[model samples]
Structure formats: structure tokens, C-alpha cells
Target: MRWSAGWHGSAGSDRRPAGGRTVPGLREVWTCGWPEARVRAVGDGPVALAVIGECGADDAQLRDALPVVRAEGWRALTRWPGSYLVIARSGETLAVIGDLAGQHPVYYRTDAAGTWWSTAASALAALDGAPVDVTALAAHLAFGQPDVLAERSLFRDVQRVPGGHLLLVGPGGVAVEPYEPAAYAPVGLREQAPVVRAALAEAVAARIDDRPVSADLAGLDSTTLACLAAQRGPVAAVTFADERLRDDDLAFAARTAATVPGLAHHPVPGAPGTVYYAGLDDLPGLPLTDAPNAYVVTASIKRAVLDTVAGNTPGPGVHFTGAAGDAVLSAPSSYLADLLRERRHRRAWQHALGHARLRHTSSFAVLSRARPASRVDLAGAWWQTAAELRRPVRDWIPQAQRPLAWTPLLASADWMTPDVRGLLADAVDEAAGALSDAPARLSDWSDRQDLARVGANTSGWRALALAGHGIELAAPFLDNEVIRACLAVPADERGAPGQYKPLLDAAFTGTGVLPGFVLARSTKGGFNALAYAGLRDNAPVLRELLGPSSHLAALGLVTEQPVADALARAAAGQPTAQGALHLVVAAEVWLRQLAAAPATWWEEVSGRVAAA
Candidate 1:
């Protein structure tokens, strides 16, 4: 990688620079000591392309991926997983894009002369000419982080490329287009499930080769992949040790790997990392805008784990992950359905009920022992009371005057379907012709879409951490062909054989590398208990970071005393709604980071204005 402009590039090889200093028009490129072939790029004309981080996938795997990049040129291809950014020079134009899902945060800005560029957005504000967006600060105070909406960034002009999107900066102006999730006709469940399984097996085998590979070693996804690969070659599996945050995963990984013949299992310490939870770029004594929590700390923790794993071993091997498999293959509609069905939790249900004013009576109340009349009151909280309590004035004119909005996210699938499908009756059928476009209920369609994206998104985040170590991580389940085939499968077959990722499991069922129980296990490990415990253990930091801020109290929607009392109760082992709220507070720390950044940085990034 080349460093152009005024950017100074340094990593472990260079001494640390003093804090709070700023650089202007500097470009630096750093990569972990992965093979040079691992970071190859090709483009001509006005292109300045960089393919850094962990993208090499063995010779055969490279053969599969290279054709896509070569054919599409610099456009974002759908199948690439892990933490990555592709900056391409097409003709006289420049475009930098991240993977379909945000595995890592990408920050960029157009210069004063309007030439666009991207760098790690995390600390870009520390650079010269970056602007700050205070309204993003307010939104961060309200929503915890700023990327909840598409094209909005903490710094005004710096924007995030939405998942399944490409950002093109050309003389014609900036154009963002969705990649990976091409529209395809839906197919029947039985036929599609097997196809997904076959495509994924092929993708995994192509990348892993005959060498040993690594798996995260948990339930469903990783275990299944390890088993499949074992049929073709020896494999290694790793998991976090029995620490506060990784206790359940350690046991699950060990147990699963035990069944894989000739597979080695490595359990490394997985502790909460210690870093700038709110902003890694913040200088000492400069307050952060959001809470810095254990997850950020995980970055360092992951690096240490991988380093130890590599030192114990000899050469590099493909690392397999279940990443984003949930988003790409599983249904999130269950959570939404649970809210609608469990009529007793009105406040909780408000968060899941479809947009206010569209509530409908369903059989869920009868299914859950709550009466229909009681459920009606639950609707009031989500529909009328909650909105009025949160804000009297609508943020904008009511939806009645707005273009009907549509997103393919399926909140709940258990209940409500045909009713919801009516909302998107006029949507384009891109996923048609090749597959069965059966007029399924809207709920089923939503569930399918969620499953398709979650796996890629989740794996992408893990891949980001691996990138720091320069390890190429791949998720066979995230292969576009696998996803497209899964899309062809019927809903029942999608979750068949009593397994959540049945198609994925079935793809490896004959491999004989995984234990029968590992493949058949239905229960998922719950990580929330440990995470909440950690939060309670660190209550002092939480209070110090959030208590002084009047952002929540000023809204008047929530009483300050109750919020404070709840935190106290949680710290004393009494977990409540307040504990979950703290997660939001932790995210707020990052928002504050963006809000307080230099104004010039914000202006060069997201193209927004703010209050002083």
C-alpha cells in the first residue's frame, strides 16, 4: 500500500506520536505481515485503489473471488466477507466502499475542492479540515450512535455506506447503490435449502484447501462449518476461555470440536478490552461524547488471542466464522412476534409493535393467556401514549403525506403475514423468474430477508478484528450463491430437521467431522447474562459517564431519579430495564465522540450543518 498526500503511515514499526496533534492531507497504509498476495489490487485509468486487510483465500479461493472483482472492476461484489474497504479509481473518478454490512466503520470526506476521500472515520476528526456535527451529538445522546439512518455521519459530510451499498464519487455527483443483495425470484423451501448447503460446502472447501483451518467453535454455524471441512482436511478450532464473557462459548466450542476427528481445539482468554469506549481518538482530558464499553475493549483482547494462537501454530490458515449467518439466514421476526404475543409487557411491546397507528388484533393474546381487551391497552402504549409521551410534535408531517416507505426487514414471522405483504404489493420482483415467486405472506418474506443479511454482517464485525491481526477470515455460509439458494428454499425446509440453520448443517451432515449432538443441538448460548454482569460490575464508570449528562432527563419522557435508582438496583444484582438502557448509554459515548469532533472534519465528511 502507498501513502500519498501528507499522511504519515506507521504501525508496530514506528514510534507512537504525541496525542492531540493533527495532520493535514496525509495518507498512511499499514497491514499486518500477511502475504503480499493477500492484499492485491487491480484498476486503471483515474483509479487509486487499495485492497488492504485480510482478503486472501488460498489459491483456489482466490481463483473464485478474483473473477468477480475482475469482471465487476471496482464495484462492490456481494460475496466478500470480513472487514474490508475497496477504494477504486474509475476513469477520473474515485470511490471507496466497505463490505455489504458494516464489519468496520468507514469514514470519508470531500475536500474543500470537492474531491472525495475515505479514511478510518474513527479518529479522522483529529485530522485537519474535518468538521463536527452537534445535531448528531444530540441524536447520539438520543439514539446512542449516529448510523441508525442511511447516509448520516457524526461529522456532517462524512457518511457511512449502508449495508449492501456502493458509494460512487464522480463528476456527476455521489451515487450510492446496493450490491450483493440483487433482486431474485423466491423459490420453494425444500429445493433452495439443499442448494444453499451445496454452494456453501463448495465455497468453504475451495478456500480452506487441504490445510488446517480455524473455527470460532460455538453453536450452529462455526461447528457446522468445521465438521464440513473436516471431511476434506484436518481442521483446528478456537474459542474464548471460561471468562466472565466467554464461559458458555468455551464449553460449547470444546464440546463441538471434540467430535471432529483430527481437529485441534484451542481455547484462549477472552476478556473485556480496555480502550477508549467512547472515542479511541480522544486526547487525554478531552471529554468523549459516548460511553466506551467492553466491546471496544474486545478489539485488543481479540488481537492478543490471535497472536497467542498464531505463535503456538506455524503458518497461516483460513479462519471460519458463523458471522452474519444469523442476519443472512435466520429470522428476527421471532422477537417482534414475542412482543405482539406476550400482551402483559406493554412497555416492552412498544419497541416491537409495527409503526404506530397500524396495530391490529391478533391471536397472540389468546395464545399467551392475556385477554384481547388487555392487549388493546398494549397497543395504546405503542400507538398513542408512547408517541405523545416521547414527543408531542411529529418529527415531520405524518406518514399520510409521505411516500410509502418500504424495507425488506422482517420483524416477526410467527404471526401476521399476508396482512404485511399487502404493504409491498407493488415492489419490484427482482428475486423472481429463476426461483418460485410464490405469493407468500409478508412476514415470511421479511424473515427470509433478515436471514440473508445477518450472517454476513455479524461475521464482518469479527473479520474486522481479525484484520488488525492480518488474518484472512472467511464465512462459507456468507457466499452469495449459498444465500441465493437459501432464498430459493421454502420457510419450513429452511428450519428443518429441528435445527435453526438446517440447510447449513445438512450441507455437512455426511462429512462425519462433527458430533451428532453438535449438529442436532437446538439451544443457543446466551451471552447477555455475562455482558450485563460486566456492566453491573463496572457501575461506577457508567454513572460517571452518564449521570452528569442531562440528555435523558431533559427529554422529560423518563424520570431521572428512577433511572438512577434502576442503575443502583442493577449494580446490586437486580437487573432491570435500566441495565439494557445502559447499553444504549454506552453507545452514546461514541455519539458524543462525533458531536465534539472538530467542525471542519464534520463538514468534509457527511455534508451536514449543526448548531454551535
Candidate 2:
């Protein structure tokens, strides 16, 4: 529920401003859940700089850099070690910069009086009592891509500052401008390994303070972070082990903890209540997020682990999770399309053969999908995808079996009403029309989109942890410097076949921070058993939640009968539309919570003009 808000324009209000700081241009800023230590400011009056979050810079450094950032643009403010939001003011101009990931997204609503901005879209939405944007929500459920409606928020009239972009409010007006490119010049993985290692180390170090530290030790990504955290001091390493999860994660976790110093292993045994959708009945207990959060569906399991950490560590502390590790370190097999587009026929064929073997399909089949994608640019692919979405709903096909494109349509598209699909298609078409400067390669766009999707969801997870347990969730992989270092390497090398996260392996191998066994292990784990169990056990509640009065059904976004059918399939142990159903349920919960939320996001100021 932490947020910061401000506005730039005339000061018409007679009432004194609430407890907040005021700058030039009659602007006022207010923040909540931000300690004085987390808030740093430099300069005064017309020229000032404020940073809020875990920034790894002292006041002296910020003071030295203020002039440079004021003379130049806000891009110069992003080179700091840790993740933070920068608010800069010079004369009548103000710039608000969020991280490259959507973790600290910036949202605003502009009108005649002024432009109001905040870190929470929900807060801004509450200012004017704006309703949810059905088309934007449809696009979110259908694509799971953050940038489909790049400028639109889930709430009507509330605009989102797109990832890697800054919000600038000046005497002229408000504008969203990009401070970072969609892709970088390709660097070899070998050359970028040290950079990756250093960035990740710094990211971990940034979160290490007097607070107790803990991290997930489930997979290589989390394990790497846990080991890295251990390098600084003692870490309360947690492993969620259940008899039903037929994986070696717990075994590997125990081995790593036994070998590594300063890692106290805590094995949390899963119970019947510790399953997905286990706590959906109590919607009021769930923390309100800015958007539909995937974490809501799996909050039971997450809370179980958090409860364990809270037991070990008494008070507020930092908990790290390997949320976006896969998105950053490993590119999808679609990188084969990039290889083909670059005229590397031999490398493309070799990669296709390797991928085909892993997928148990023919090499020609893999290349067939890649060839078409290689010929299509981002806008072209979006146009083609819109055309396909506008057609008749197709049968349920596994996502892996679907044809590769710039953005692959998920099974959730089938669950939406035709009218909603049309709306979503139109939105996608409009977005495609606006992408005049999109990334050239499919991998570049997809990689960034994937990171954004994960980052947004993890923000929800952070909210949940903070509200429920007073713990701050950190995802080192999503840090600005780490992303810059890892993504500079070509996607093809990062996602090479027969290898698991080659980028991470290259970065940490022989570094002595991660164990050799962890670097060598390739088998990953899943939660299929728990997901099915949760569906079976919570079927009655889920049915009622998505029943006749579902908000999504009222909005024509999702058809009730198809979702009910999907639930039945899940109960019957069929290859059901689990992922799509998860999206539907998350959206449903979010809509309900939004309806019940109180409009207490802003401070009371007399005679303030309402947003237009």
C-alpha cells in the first residue's frame, strides 16, 4: 500500500498542504511507507533531486550528480547501483523516472489544472473515482504482456508510464519519453559474465543492511541468490518440501546448505491448506494490488513460506526471491527466429534440430515456425496476431504446441467472449499501429515483455509480503544494472539448446559463490501436483466466485460456462486451461477488491480542483 504522489500547476487551494514537501511551480509531494533513511534529497527551491527506494548512493553523490541530471535528461540518473525512483525538478520542469522493470511503475492523469502522478495507479484512479477499463483489462488477460496498451492503465483515464520510460511534466505539458532503448548492441556472453556477476552482487549488497536476510533455495536462480546473500552474513534459507512434489529441489537445497557457510536451512513441510487457491474465500484478507496479480492465486503457498521465515526472524526483514531470473537469464526458443533473421542459416538449423529433439518434434516443424516469425517484424506480427484473434475461437492447444509469433496467443483468448476478443484485437491493432520504433528482433521484444510481466506480478507479491508479514521482497534479477548486463549478450547464446540458463552459468561458474553442483544441475521443478490439488479441493468456492455475478462476466470479458468447464476438466484430471483460469480468477478477485476499496489514497486539501 506504499505510494508517493505529487502534482505540478497553479496553487488555487486555500487550505495548507498536508505533511509533505513543496517545490517550485506550486508543486507538492507526499509519500507513505517510506522511511526517512529511504528518502534522500539534494538541492533546494527550483532545482532539487529526490530518490526514494534502496538507492546505493550517499547524499554527496546525489548532490554531485544533480547538476548533470538537470542539464542533461533523466537518463543520467539511472546509473546508480540499486533500484530506486528519481524525481527531479529544475525551473518549471519536473521529471519522474521509474525503473526499467515495472516494479516501481509510474502512473499519472493530466487535466487543465495540472498533471498528477503517483507510484500507485489505484491511488490516482481513486482521485476521480474512475471505473476499470474493460478493453485494457481484456488486453491484459488475453496477452499477459504489459505494453499491449502501453499508455493505458487498468483504470480509465489513468495513464501508465511505460517501462524504461520517464514522465516529464513541464510548462508546456506532460510527456512520456524513453530513457533506454528496447535492445542493446550484442555482446558475447563471455565478455558480459563478469559484468553480470558484479551487477548481481551489487544488487544483493544493496538490500543487505542491519535487517535479517533470507532467500528461497528452491532452484538455481534462488539458490544463487541465497548463496550470494550468505557471502555477506547469515541467511535463513527456506525450502518448501511436499511429498506430492516429485522434484529434487529439497534434496539439492539441503546439499547446498550443508556445503555453504552462513546458510541455516529451514525446510517447510507443505500441508493441505498450503495449496493454490486455498484462501480465495476470504477476499477481504488479500492485499489490494495495483492490478490483477498472479500471486493472488498462489498466496497460500507463499504465506506458508513467509510464516516460516517470520518464525525464524522475529521482526521486519528482507526476503529475496528468484522471481524474474528465468525471464532475464534465459531467452525463449523463439531466439531461433532472430538467428534466421540475421542470415545465420547454419546456426538456425542447428538450433532448430536441438530444440526439436528436446520437444520431441521434427526439426522442420521447429524451423517452419521460426521461418514465418523471422519474416515478420513486430508490427506485422501484431497485425497477424490480431487477425487470428478476431477469427473463430480455436480448440484448446498446449502453449508449447502453438505456433511462435511476436506474441503468442495463450489459451485464455479462447475463454473470452467474441465481443471482448474483438475489442482486444482492436486494441492490439492500435498498439501495433503505434509501434513505429519497436525492436527489430522478436527475441528482443519478447524478452523485455516477459521481464515486465514478471516484474509487475512480483510487485504484487511484494505488497502481499509487506502487508501480511512486514517483509520487503527483493528480486535481484530485475535490478536495472543486472538487466543491462545480462540482456546485452545475444539471446541465442543465452538460450542455446541442451543447456539450462547458459547466461547464469557463464556468469557464476568458477566464481566460488555458487556451488559447482548447483551450476551443473539442469533439472527444474514444478507445482502441477499442488495446482491440481488446490483446484480439486477448492472447486466449490471457485465455482461460486466465477458464477453468475462474476464482474468479468458482467463486463463481457470472460464467459462463465467456459471457465466452469475448465474447472470441471481440472477436477477430472484433464489437460485443462489452468493458466487461463488463473488469469480469470485473479482478475475477478481484483475487481471485487477494487469495488470494496475505500478512497483514502490522498490527503485532504480544501479547494483542490478535481481531475478532468
Candidate 3:
């Protein structure tokens, strides 16, 4: 719920005119939920800079970055370790820089008076009471990709600045400028491992300070973080163990805790209520996230873990999650397409065989799918996907088995109505027409898009943790430096089969930080059983939520009868539209909460209101 907003014009000018002489100055911006200590400002009056969030920069660095950013643009201020937002004012020009990841997104709206910007799109939308943009929401639900319509926010008239970009507002006008490239120059995994290790260590170190640090020890990424944090001091490592899950995560967690010193293992046993969709009955209690967050469906389990950490730590604490580890550390099998594009046929076949073995399919099937992707550029792929969306819905296929594309349409795309599908297809076509500077390789573009998706959702999870438990959630894997270090390595090697998170293994092995057992572990646990159980138990509530009166259905996005049928199939333990339903339900919940949201994000001063 933390946000900050400012403007480059005199819409809300605080200065009174002396003798009918209007002062030409920028209005004072407003903020909420930001502590004074976390807020850092340098310079004064017209030319100044301010940073809000968990920034690792001091006054010296801020003073250094201000002039550099003015001369070099927004990229100069992005070298810091932690995630943060930078607002710089150089004379009449102002720049707002968001992180490489969408964890800290920037949204703005421009008009005759001036341009207004904020960290929260909803806040900007509230200035004009903008309604939901159906096409954007349709694209979000159907594609599940972040950059499809990168500039469109969920609320109409509130424009979003894409990740790795900055919003520059000056006397001339407002413009969105890219500060970073979609992909970095290729580096071998071996050469990049040490750099990644250093970046990750710094990212983790940035979060560790006076606060009590706790981490999730359920998988390799979180385990690495827990071990790293343990080096600093004691860390409360939590593993949510539910008998219904029947996973080996708890066993591995216990072994790691026993071996790794300074890690006090606290296993939180899951109750029947600790399942996905467990808390949907009380919609008002949920935090109003700025976008549709998948974590809303599984907040019960997250809350359970947070409650355990809260019980152990007496005061405010920092929780580390391995949110974007898979996105950054490992590439998808889509890297096989990148291999085929490079004419590395032998390597492509070998990797395809490995992936086929993992999926229990023929290698030819994997190669055939990747071959088509190799032949098509990003725009062509989007065009083909738009054509498919315009046609009838296809049968449900597991997302992992889908063919590699620029943006693979998920099973959720099948859940929308025909009209909505057409709208989404048109939007996709428009986005394809606008795709001029896409990354040359599929893996490069897809990797950044994947990171953006995970980063955005993790921001929602951070908000949930903060609002519900007074805790700060940190994801070191999504830091700008860590992303640059890891993604610079070629995707094929980073996602090379036969090794799990090869980048992490190479970085931490022989370093004596993460244990050999953890680095060697290949199998990761699944929460399918818990998800199904939650769906079965909460059928009535879901039926009511996605029924005819649902907000999503009211918007003509989801068909009411089909959603009800899907819920019935889910409750009966059949192959159903669980993923799609989660998106629909989450969007529905978000819409409901948005209607009830208060306009407390801004405060009116001296009867002068800032127009959004």
C-alpha cells in the first residue's frame, strides 16, 4: 500500500501568488506508508532528488547520482543493489526511474496542465476515477504475460511505464525512455558465476540490517538465501509442511537446518484452512493490490507462514523469498529455440532429448515445437498467436507442454468469452505491430518478461505480508545487479538440462556457503494436492464468487456458465481450468476491492487539488 506521487506542472502549486504574479514551480508530491528513514533526498528547491524503498545508497551516492543522472539520463541511478524508485528534478525537467524488475512500477497520466506520476496505478487512476480498461484486463487474463501491452495499465487513461524504462517530464512534454536493454550481451555461465555470486551476496546483504531476518527454506533458491543470511546472524527458516502435500520439502529443510548453523528451523504444520482459496469469503479483508495478483488465491498458506515468523520474531522483521529464482537462474526449454536459431543443431537435439526425457515425451516433439519458434520472429509469433486467439478455443494443454513462442497463450485464454477473445486478439495484433525493438533471441525477451511477471506478483505478496503481518518481503533474485549478472549468461547454458539451477550450483559450490546436499537436490515439491483440496473445500464460495453476479462476468470477460462448470469439474477432482480460474477469481476479488478502496492516497493542501 506504499506509494508516492508527484507532478512536473503547476497543477497543485503550494506557493501563493504575490501581487497577482503566479509562481512557476512544481507542486509538492504526496506519499504514504513510507518511513522517514527509508526516504532519502538530495539537492533542494527546483533541482533535487529523492529515493524511496529499500535502497542501499547513502547521501554521498545520491549526491553523486543526481548530476550523473541529469547528464547521462536515468541509467546512472540504477547501479545500486536494492530495489527502489528514483525521482530526480533537474531545473524544469523531472525523471522517475523504476527498477529493472516491475517490482517497483511507475504509472502516469498526461493532460493539458501537466503530467502526473506515481508508484501505484490505482492512485493515479483515482485522481480521475478512471474505470477498468477491459482490453488491458482481457490481455492480462488471456496472455499472463507482462509486456504484451506494456504501456497499458488496468485502469483506463493511466499509462504504465514498462520495466527498465523511465518517465521523463519536462517543459516540452512527457516521454518514456528505456534506460536498459531487453537483454545483455552473452556471457558464459562459468565466467558469470562469480559475478552472480557477488551480486546475490550484495543483494542479500542489502536487506540484512537491524531488523530480524527470516527466510523460506523450502527449495534451493530460498535455502541458498537462508544459508547466506545465516552467515550474518541467526535466521528463522520456515518450511510449511502439510500432510496433504506429501512432499519432501520438510525432510530436506530439516536436514539443512540441522547441518547449517544459526538457522532455527520452524516447521509450520498446515491445517485444513491453510489452502488456496481458503479466505475468499471475506473479500474486504484482503489488501487492495494495484494489479491482478495470483498470490491472492494462495494468501491463506502465505499468511500461515507469515504468522509463524511473526510469532517467532517479536518486532518488525524482513522476510526473504526466492521469488524470481527460477526466472533468473534457469531458463525454460524455450532456450532450445534459441539454440536452433543459432544453427547449433547438435546441441539443440541433445538439449531437446534431455527435455523430452524430463517430460516423458519424444525428442522429435520438442524439436518440432522449437523449430517453428526458431523460424519466426517476435512479431510473426505474436501474429500467429493472435490468429489462434481469434479462432475457437483449443483444448486444455498443460502450459509446460505448449509450443515455444514469443508469448505463449496460456489455458486461461480459453476461459474468456468470444467477444473478449476478439478484443484480446485485436490488442495482440496491435502489440505485434508495435514490436520494433524486440530482443533478437526468444530466450532473451522471454527471460525478461518472465522476470517481470514474477517481480510484479512478488510485489503484491510483499504488500500482503506488510499489511497483514508488519513484515517486509525481500526477493534478492529480482535485484537489478543480480538479474544483469545472471541473465547475461546465455540462456541455453543457464537452462541446460541434467542440472537444477546450474548458475546457483556453479556460484555457490566449493564456496562452503550452501551445502552440497542442497546444491545437488534436483526434485522440487508441488502444491497441486493442496490447491485441489482447497478448490474442493471452497466450492460454494467460488461458485458464488464466479457466478453470474461476479464482477468479471459483469464486465463480459468470463462466461458465467463455463466458470461454474469449471468449478464443478475442479470440485469433482477432474482436469479443470484451475489456473484460468485463479486468474479470474483474483481479478474478481481485485475489482471488488477496488470499488471499496478509499482515496486516502492523496491529501489536499490549501484547497488546491492535483489533477491526475
Candidate 4:
């Protein structure tokens, strides 16, 4: 498509509230920016309501769930959740509803005039003119992953809107069902610690709507949503610190702002603000065209942590963040699939030999890495690839069996070049046919497949890049009633290991809420020296944004001498070339900002739908 885009609104709706109740053929658009989304339309009454990114309640819960989704269509659109998008229209029959961890992401395209969805998949792939496949951007630059379990979208007719389904278009065409978290039983640990302490105290009191918030005290689900958002009202917390790393979580966020109460910690500091990664050569801007999180953080560390949390938060607040609570509270041995579904084959080999002596490894490398389709076949050929050069035939083509779901620790494809490793193994065999090469290893099937591969991430694109700087990020652990009360414990007691998220340490130590020196510390901190010092302070603007007029090296989809030998083996840190140099510099900075985005851009809106 095209590029150069920003600030476009009006999915149309609004006008008729001077005594309220207008309903005639609905079209209620609303986006006073600061990252807002509210497009409603359903007067001939079928269904339409929106609440894209962060949500708990938006305008009287879409005026009390728009008459239960125009009276039960696609089952009242999964009641409500943190990330959302719902559209139902009755004529021409359009339907779409994605929540339950599809994380405010819908992205559609049917055409001939009917289904055109949003949640900005490259601005609906430049309003459906759609193009740029480059072999699904070489399968998301080698077995992609940035919006998990792949529904495909490097654009070749854009699509996505899979997590717990529901996308029906009509005229007898496109369809997809399955509403909320269809199921999750087995609740123990004394009734799953008071339903995860009253669903994380009503998901930190509905984003402390009483205003001022900043949260994130480096883990323990942002120190239990900053001690339950400082029990309501004024909170700041934050924490980054760098000091050229070694250990920094701002000393457990200054001992969680010296024991909560009206919070106020802040921290940030790490050389010129979260190490501003220096002018990343016109750093992928133009509102990150086709952004599935255009390179997950580093536009000078997301403009220095959004100018240190919107310049030390005061007005227009809420920053929270626990970032999808480590794939919805930990995974590894998927708690030996809940001790072999309670038949307890010798207590699932003694909980996979106590997670192989607390990760020293080998209890059969912790039961074939507790095979959840072998970590979704190496997260579809790698994005999170660091476990000491992740393996897939380790060293290259060796595995005998039990790991075939997705094995690409690149024994070959030798960090890509022979035609970018056969277009990244045909985009990791089309994201291994969208997973499940044998999944059913129960016990919150590793937190139900790590909450459907945590799509829309890096803390939901750092809350949509702090809504172009005005801030509003809340993540009281991805609330849908705090992840259905942290899936009622048991996925091996929420992956123990010094209890960082052991059901957020047994739901705030059975609700005392903190103490045990901020939930028994035991390491859960990181800032990574501002991304290992932005690979030597933006090494020549990431070598001219992956040089040689890099449109992913003019469509061979990357091969400029393996991008200077994977940036000299990720500048020597070598955690598999520093996670393949952030998946090849965030896939050449999102194909150089989706080829400078602009297929038909628009943006001009100001306060309360231009006040009538």
C-alpha cells in the first residue's frame, strides 16, 4: 500500500444525546485521541460497540452493553475484557468480536463492499488495497511472532482476529465463531486464593478511574498493580534505572514505594531517560505503518519511556503495566500438565523433577521442554529465541521425534541468506499451520496456550505508544476479571520459581498484599541496560536502517550479508545474535515503516466529537 499516515478517526457514530436515546441507524464515532476508540452503530439494531485497547468500562459500559449486543448476537460479545473490538451489523451481515486475549486486535478485509475491520493492522492494510507479502515479510522475518499463534498478516489480503474467535461476514461468506474463554476448570489452592483475591481487587479497582496512575514496580504483576493501585487514587510507582545494568528494578521499586500508601516512587533514570537510543536514523515513524508493534520498543526507548511517563504524570493519567503477566503468569513445564491431569504419574515425574532442579535443566530437559507443541515450534522459528541458542535439531537437524511441532533453532537457514532461508522456511511452514501439532497437555494448557500467544504486545505496543504521548496504559494483569482469577491457580501452582507470579504470590499472600520483602524478591527485574546500550548507541542508525536501500534488502526479504553478520553477532553478546538482533531489527523496522505508510491517510479530530 502507501505510507505517511497518522490521526485518522470516524468509524462514524455520535450525535443525539441532548435528552439521549436516538437510535435510528446508529453511527457513533468517538476518538478524542490520547489513544481512544469508540465506534458504535446499530440503530436498525443488530450490534456494534467498540473499546479497542485498554478497557474496564468505557462510557457506561457502552451504554450498558448496547442492549446485550442487540439482544444476544455472538453471545453478548464476551461480556467485557481489557482488550476489545466488537462489530455486529445486521444488514449485509457483518460480525466481529475479539477480546479474550486477542488483545484489542481485529484486522479484517472481505470486500466487494461489506467487511472491513480495524484495530489498525497497518491501517486496515492501507484500507484494504492490500499488498506487500514479501512472503509474509519472510514469515515475520524468520518464523514470525508479534501477535501470536499466527492468523497471518504481513499482508497478502490481511487477516487476524483469531483469539477466541467470532468473525462472521455474510452473503454466505467469511465466518469464525467461539466467544470468550470457552472453558477452564480445576480450581484449588484453597479455592484459588479467594478467586485470585477478588479478581485482583476488581482489576485494581477498575484502573483507578479516580485518576492519577503510573504503576509498574518491576514485576509481581507490577507489584500487584502497585499495591492494588495504592488502594485507590494517587499512585506513581514506575521503575527503570539502568546504571549500566547488572541489577536494577529500582531496588524493588524503592521497596515498592516504601510500602504503598499513596505510592510515589518514579525512578526512570538510565542516562538521558531510559537511554534514548539516539536518532535511529529517522527511527521508524509515520505512526509505525502496519504496526504489529513496529519493532517492539526502541524509537529511543519508546521516546524515553514516553518522556518519563508523560513527564512525571499529573494530568491525563494511567500507565499501569505488568505486560501480559509473563504470558498470563508463567510457563515452562506447564506444571507437568497439571501432574498428568491428576492421574499423577508419580506426580508427573515428581513435577518434572522439580522443574529439573529449578531449571538447572534435564529432567529430560524438563520433559521435552514441557512440549506445548514444542514451544509452538520455536515460537514459529524465533522471536523470543535466547535460551542459549534455542534448538531445533540443536546444532541443526538432529532431533529424533517428540519435538517436531516447530523445530527451527536454525541448524541450516544459517541465519538466513540462501534466499532468506527459503523465505524463512515458508514462514515457518505457515506458522506451523496455526499450531496444535498435538496440544492437549492440560492444566491450563500452559495458561491456555499462553493466552493465545499474547498478540499485540511489548505491553500492548507500550499501550499504543502511550497514545502518541498523552498516556493511558493500564494492565491490571489483562483483566477479564483478572484473567478469570488467574485461571484459578493450578497450572503447577502458577510456575513457582521463587514465586514471582505464583498466583501473584498466592494472591497477595492470601491478601495481606505485600511484605515478605515485596513478595520474596528472588529475581524478577530487568531493563537490559537500555537494550544493551542500543547496540552501541544506534550503531550508525542501525547501519542505515539495515542498509543497501533495504526494503528488507529489496525483497529477497533480507540478505545484505546476513545484515552485517547479524550485526556482528548481536554486537558480541550473542544470545543467538541477541535474539537475532531483535528479529532482524524488528524486521527491518517493520519493512521500513510499512514502506513509508500511506495508502489513503486521514486524521483530524478534536475534543468531544467536535462538540456537536
RMSD of each: 11.4, 2.1, 3.4, 24.1
Summarize candidate 3's per-residue lDDT along 345-365 as a digit string, tens digits.
999999988998998999999
Judged by lDDT, which candidate is best? 2
Q: What ranking emerges by TM-score with the best candidate at the front?
A: 2, 3, 1, 4
Query: TM-score of every model?
Result: 0.61, 0.96, 0.95, 0.31
Residue 85's C-alpha lDDT in candidate 3? 84
Off by over 4 Å in 2: 12-27, 607-612
User: What lDDT tens digits, residue by residue, belong to model 1 across residues 1-612?
Assistant: 111111221211121112211121113333333345445555333333455443433435434444444354554433443234555544534445565334333444554344333433433444443454533333333323222233455465666565446666556766766554434565765456566666666667656544446667766777767767667766667765635543356676777666557568877765444221322222222323212232442344445556655755556666776755654455433233333434435632443233232324333432232222223322221233223223322222222222211131111111112322221121112112122322223224344334423432344334444444445567655554565666555433453323466655555465554576766666676555444565565566656544546333332222345456656766676645432353345444444544455322221212334211
Q: Which has the higher TM-score value, candidate number 1 or candidate number 4?
A: 1
User: Which candidate number would show the highest TM-score if scored against the true structure?
Assistant: 2
Q: What is the Å distance of residue 103 in model 3 from its true position?
A: 1.2
The residue-by-residue lDDT of candidate 2 on 246-275, one tens digit each, is 899999999999999999999989999988
The collision pairs in model 2 are none
**Candidate 3 lDDT score at position 66:** 59
Looking at model 4, which ten-residue stretch has the lowest summed lDDT? 1-10
Q: How far off is residue 485 in model 1, in Å? A: 4.7
